[model samples]
Target: MKKRKTLLLPLARQFTVILILFTLCTVCITIYSTFGYSRLQTSFLNNSLESYSAQLAKSTREAYESYENICYSIAYSQVVQNYLMSENRGKSYENYRQLENQLSNTALLNPYIIDIAVYGQDSTFASLCGSASNYEEFSRSLSDSRFPYRSAGVATVNRTLCHVLAMPIYSLGTGESRYLGILFLAIDVNNLLGNSLKSDENDYDPRILFTDASGQLIYGEPQLYDALCREEDRSDVFQIQETSDNPVTYAVTGYSIPGIEHTLYVLIDKSQITRQVARISGRQLLVMCAITFLALLFLFLLYRPLIRSLKQLTDFMNTISSGDRRAMKEGAVIHQGLIGSKEISEISTAFNDMLIETEKLNHTIFDTYTRMYELENNNRKTEIAFLRSQINPHFLYNTLTMICGLAAEGMDDKIISVTGALSRIFRYSIKGSDMVTLEEEMSIVRSYLMIQKERFEDRFTVRYEFSEDSHDCLIPKMVIQPLVENAIVHGLEKSLEPGELLIGAGRNPEHGYLAIWIFDTGVGMPESRLTELRESIHRSVYNKTGDASADLEDLNSQNHESIGILNVNSRMVLYYGTDYTLLIDSEEGVGTNIQIRVPYRLKSDTNARAAQNTNSKGENHVPGNCD
Candidate 1:
């Protein structure tokens, strides 16, 4: 009776339900089956193709690299390096040939190399075993190479064409001017490629050919249409594309050989396997059709329920796509179907994470630009300050000269020493415009010490000792003088008894820097003052002002008495960075010490060299040794 009611229902409604269900189910099943089957086959074949391609590529790459290695080994031979260094022009042709012969015999792996060409800088080409017939042709051909080594030619032997590769040999001299020669290797590319691609199976064979950038064949001369031959347009194709399908049905890969400036390709064919994958089964198709009809009948019985479930899925997708992230965060529009899924939830999470990262990236970029702008502004101001500071020393030097002249006329015994020291100090101030020798800075320090001794006579003594090797090391001018002056005025001037100020300069073997120390036996500083000085030396302008209770606060916030120390420290850091200079150690009652470490070698700087001559005037006199 139920079957009869169903049959009596309107045919269109019943037919539509069954047909719709059948089409949906069969379409889903067939699409899944087809894609799954095709992907598996394609993946398997691609993997095989790639694996075969990789192995062949590795073999060919190793062969070419071996050839390159051998050529480089010959090129960098001590004999060659020594010959180039000795400036042996084209005269050492026989000696170069003997070297080439020895290298050819030594390379057991690639013994077929017939000749080597050494191209000298004068466009003359010389070879160890090549013939005289094509020497002119070879030389003319080589004019393009500029054969910085021996000769300008095709670098041939016996007038027979050969596979060739060459590398530019360089002299071990410093600077951009030391190139000496070009080393050429005449090789059998066919033999190299053949031996490298030797297959294990009898049925499989591989062939390789070498060509120039223009796609003209350069090697494998005897066989034109062999297993490997030049294709009509293959040469042009390889130049443009890195990878392409080989019309021969073989998997292929390309690599650029060093020194050759051309592409080498490797190939493997899979025509048979591809044909097998194309074969389909007729019986299976019939069985699939039967299954489709049965599914249609079952779906008509549950049409209403299916529509309701689809609506639920639609609503879930819409909720996730909404721009309101907060709504999604609350986990609204949950899927409660028997076939539950969490894919929608995961997508939402990933989207939110992406938004968060984008915001952070934007903020970081903005902050970086802002900080860069502020630093540029500060740099400009510092330049202005430095220019202003330069003006006063000239006037100071003139005043000292007049004083020294007056004193000299009166036969003051100490007048000459003071005048000389003061004069040197002024000249160095101008001379150290950019950089000065270690010898120059020491001169300034000696002069400053002299002035102090005259002002505070018999109160203190200073001594200096420096390594002979480190005398040539360059350092900033007037760097040491200011520190010495500080020590005398702040430490020794106040003392009654004679105090000792010992200055020592030497190279530090461990750090590769010059370590200079100024030690004084005078009134030392208290812990509070020492701490304040350290803070001022390291404090940045950005943190100059902050809450009073800030941790690591500036203790010298009252008066910038340590400004000189801070300035020197900052300048040292700005130039060589904090790793180099302005090290201070002090103790109450005992003494104070300052060490300035700088790189021990003058880094060939143009400005330093230009100022070297102008800066030699005042380095000889003792600063405070005047009687």
Candidate 2:
């Protein structure tokens, strides 16, 4: 009694929920089971219906075989095959009549047979249904006389469907003896197929129909054809469907006869069979409901603890959904990691880490964006100053030409050589354009040495070593001129004894750039002055001025006409960036080596034509002056 009381306490708590669920389940099961059972029963009845129809078709096929046999027997008869092989034609009527009588008797045994006919080769004589007749009636309808037999559907004397089966009778004799006649048989079409329906004893409703290759009706009543036609969803076979009318469930089956071109269909209605099964299903559902109610009560009692745990997890998830992260942190301690157990401790730890990491990443992204904005402003100002310093090649060319002419007419080999060097230098300047060919820039430097050689005469000597491959490469016009100027004005120009200048141009494939170095065996600056020049060239060109800070009031103010080493340095850095630049290699008294590394193809050479037009705006070229 104590055990029974404990079970009853749980049953009472789940009574309402289980009752509602049990009622809904019972109704659904009744509906589903009844539908499934009805379908199964209807399928069985359709199989039976198809079986009966197949048996009828087999019987009809046998009847057709019997009719064909009679025709074959006549075709191979000794007298008929002999007459057909001879030239007598129908002159031997008495013998032909005997064969006809035997064939007529054979056909009479076939219930579906309606008539028979025989025709001579010339179509002069014939017999039909045991009566003498002329061939005039079917002469036009006959096709070939050489083959054994042929058949066709035609109207009978009684106005009904019939198939005419005919065979060519050949004479049995020597070659080309004679020509005989043909034997024909008529079979009623409907009666031949209707034999299958007579064997079924069930109350199943059925419809019979015939159609051509296309799904158009050929025979049967109009209403019956339409009813069966609606269910013919496929061309290869038939379909079954539920209906509200008599014979509630219906299915259709179709087959094409082997020798015949027409298709036959048999539609059966088996609703009464499905209805009986539905009644049985309703009783089975009642028994299942009684057993299910007791099992559900026991399961509900056993799952009480699990249900409470699920409610606690659901409440924590709801707190997270409401944007209460603080509450979620506190709840994790109370719940002790998923249902007060060890199952989800890892998931709880991972989720908390993801939230905190996302917040930290957002702060880092904001700080980086602020830094980029400040850097961009400084870069824009420097870019403007670099672009302003690009010089005009044509103006430089005109000025050098004037200087060359003034020094040309003297006999002093010194003066003449200097003037010739001046001429070559001006010519080389024009060749520079925006992208002086490497060959042309080198020629200009050689001319510069020639002029210096005449001025210093035996005091200094210049030599060049350049790779053969560097001739066609394009670099900025006047790119090497600035470095050479620095070496002459600051290094070799101060030397007391004979000084040496060496220019080297070659490719450093390892660095992917062409390096041109100007080395002078002259006074070299200290490391401190070198550092100062390097820093000045690297500073943002935007704030640079033409005045040196030592000679001006405002050292930081921007300036025009400041075409120093810094100007060339800023332009090079702007276009090629940090990749290509000038490197100063020097030691006190030994020499100053200025190495300029540049890309094989400079950006200025690519825009040479445009750069020439822009830089030549303020100057015009004049013709040569003769004195």
Candidate 3:
């Protein structure tokens, strides 16, 4: 019962952790979606306001240009010029009637024209189309200005607000022209902007305004105009927050009409955007909640059977741990009927087999103990033999010959350096622990490469690449050197052209291992040899009882061509396990790559036996790579 409770505690903790992670992910996705959607909606609204403001400004400029053209035509008319040039009283009334008729006909050109009038320099005046009551006042305000055309500002004419324009007429008769009079054209402001100001179906309730360069309002609400003028350094698009006086927040955008010194402003209420975002956020939250609930339900269903199977297995283990022989015999048979997944069923079968083995061990405890002692002693002998195989006599003879050649050529420094590097290799190989820091191992590899460099001359080059952080990681001694040696002897030495050899070590934190690799660009092996080499390296030594001795003898009998690599593989398996062995890959005429993976351990982890056992059985094995 205690074991069952112990097992259940971890499962409960795991379920809680999974639930929390799922909820956190759901919340994060919800927040991101809501924020992104709000930003998208705001961007869309700003673009719409900008487009709307541009359209209104364009229409206003076109209308003003049309009205100015009419004023220009009337100012240069022959009949009007003739009337302004005439001084006869008898023809004055006749000229006046013709001028009035002409003005009436010109007013028909635009439906929004309220009135057209002419004020003469002699204080004479004539009107048509409407009561032109303000024409004299409008023309008198700009009497001193020399400009041919100008706006006379907004005024109440015929009890309606009108946009008035004033143009100075000149006598068309001659050389040094004389100022004849002023022509005033009054246009209905409401009718001019009516079509442009209508709200769209989206119900944004956009307010449109027209103002001069100096911020003088020509059209739109006076309150909004006053608020807009208070803002400093306004850009093409901006927002207005709700205040005490202005209770509505607005998104404001505008455009300046070129050559007219006028700007058009479009203001949209922000409440619409806020409501849209709220609706979308609410829907997202609902979906997130639904998904979270369904995910939690699935987690519960998936883990329920696993939890039950574990509880049953724990009970059986507890019965065995109690050391009651009769209870153990009964529990073993009962657990064979235990059920769950295929993996769980296999585990139950293995547990039963272990129990049956335990019963057999009770009958032959003496024999089992004797064999275990023999295996340990033989394992040590095998390791010693593997170490001896790493020191090649031919390699030493070659290095001595190269030193003699350098000495005869009077290169004393080259001979001394080569001798020193060769001595370091022998000293490091002879006196060291079976496990050493990656830095120490790499030092030996560099020493070995230096000697090889002297031996091969310019036939090959060596490159060392190692991560600084992984320099302190612990690995089996002499494991990487043999791989490097194999890369040179079997791979690079066979090539006619100069070759390159790369040796590197780094931490593979994702897989919790240390990765050491040797790559050579040289004549590579065929597919058949590559496959054969991989099978030989991966082959287990102790597949059954008393097989360790046979495997060691077989390794001794293998050819010298693969003896170095096989020795390295054998040591790694004895120390770490098959799971953390060597990986070899080769392609014909391309290259060969060899990699070694071992559990990442530091000097602080001094218990090598515990580490070996844990790596061999406790952890799942990950496949190797040559990259």
Candidate 4:
């Protein structure tokens, strides 16, 4: 029974989570864009205010320069100078009637000028006292003051703010270099600044303030005097800042009027920039919202089919888990709507094909197992039949020939022993099993060697070296006897001198194998001959195209190498696998040594590879006979 999952969520709820995540991403992007735009707009407005302040300052400077030029005109005039140094020095400037009339006409021509006054510098009775305004206050104000040339700034006149331009008077003609008296001109703010600054569109004109080099106030709106004075700084340049208690932002900048000793400060409002930001922000919000809505709609359309296909696949997989073959085929039609997408279609097709293949493979697997059993049985029958064919008449014929030759020589004892060893060898080879204990195979090898020693008593010496631990090891039958036989027939039989033959059986410490060696101190072959013999053994072992079938002809080959060493090598390979090799090492005129290695498994251990050397890898090898 399957346990119900407690944490499982429906597909719609899962999609709802996706929708929420998408909305969060949209909100984050919107907030980031809005923040960046606000910063850019603020920076632009700050820069625009600086430019507007500079332009206003320039206009204010031009307005104030006109007053300075008027002051210079009177100071350098020849008519004004002669009148100041009148022959009638005893009289006041009123006695010079033409000078008074000239001053009054100058003031009338320029409506901006509030008053034009000239005061005498003489230590004696003062000369050339005149006022353009025809006001007694101008005379009284002028009489008390003494100023240097080019002194220009803003001042209060008749309880009204005014721009004042002043300059020193020089003597006429030859006395032009000499200073005589000071000339003064005061211009009304409304008349002088209105044309350039005041707009009919709005009352919000940028106020221009004037101050002399000494930092004294010259001219500005009287109402703004206190506020501006409070915010006054030592530096000539201005900055935009919010007022201490006001919501509005204001900017100020100062410019020095050329050729005049005055600084003009232009103050502008900052609300003009704020209005633009509000308008831009409104438009941006509308555009972003519309895009976000469209994006959400697109996401819904995109993921809707995917979610439905996945839901169908999930249900189909659940039914598949219950071993329903119908669900696999049914899945194709269920998610058919998603087939337009290549990846989804491939996934669906693969899922169905895999399930179908798995079902067909179920029956094919049993057939394969049955075939494997039949093949193993055939291999066993083939190996036994090969051994029966090789060992029966041919081996008996060799023994009978040896016995008949011995009988002709009248050696009855030799024939009896040889016949006994030959009979034991034939019986062991014909046994239907391919496994034998190291002790049992060594007994057979000794019996066989005993017969050879009798036949060649004076030709060679035979020695045995067997380790006690390896005596009971299970290995392939007749694996070592052939190597000893080869040493006797090929090595000692051909040599003129008596040879030494050694047979050794021991545990190979480096590998899990029983090492059996046969060494002969006879005339050995060269390195080239040894390599040739090694290749011959390899060909016989791997005789078949594949090791799937047993090659019976490999055991029955009558070639000298194929008869003894090759047969031994091929049989050991077929039984103990290729890791077991019949290694032959020889040197010219020194000796020849042959080593046969087989897996060392104990006879008493039922789980280990026993006589047949069969293991879990399905390796079942037969007992092989050698010359």
Q: How many residue pairs clash in each candidate?
A: 22, 15, 0, 4
All candidates: CA RMSD (Å):
47.6, 30.1, 28.3, 12.6
lDDT of 1 at 123: 48
Report residue 200 deviation for candidate 2 (angstroms). Answer: 4.4
**Model 4 root mean square deviation, Cα atoms:** 12.6
Q: Between 1 and 2, whose lDDT is larger?
A: 2
lDDT of each: 0.59, 0.60, 0.77, 0.68
lDDT of 1 by residue, 1-627 (tens): 565544465444666876877688787787677667766766776665556656655665576567677767777776666655554556465566666666556444565566666665554455666743434444446545434322122234545455666667766546655556666667655555667535564234433455555545655332422334445444422221223753444444555655445556655444544553444322344566777767765664444344444455455457657755554444434343454335544554565566567557767988998997787556634532452233234335644665666576784656777777777776666543455687777777777776666666688877878888777777765567667766775677555667999988898889788988888888879999888777666563334332322312242353344544555554565567557658889887788998888887764554576577557645655688531
Candidate 4: list runs displaced more than 4 Å: 1-224, 227-250, 254-265, 269-342, 358-377, 384-389, 392-395, 401-419, 526-528, 546-558, 587-591, 606-627
Which model scores highest in lDDT? 3
* Residue 359 lDDT (model 2): 52
Model 1 residue 593 lDDT score: 94
Model 3 stretches with alpha carbons more than 4 Å out: 1-23, 79-111, 122-129, 190-194, 197-209, 213-215, 228-260, 263-627
What TM-scores do the predictions have? 0.35, 0.34, 0.41, 0.56
Ranking by lDDT: 3, 4, 2, 1
lDDT of 2 by residue, 188-220 (tens): 767766555665466655667766444555555
Better of 3 and 4 by TM-score: 4
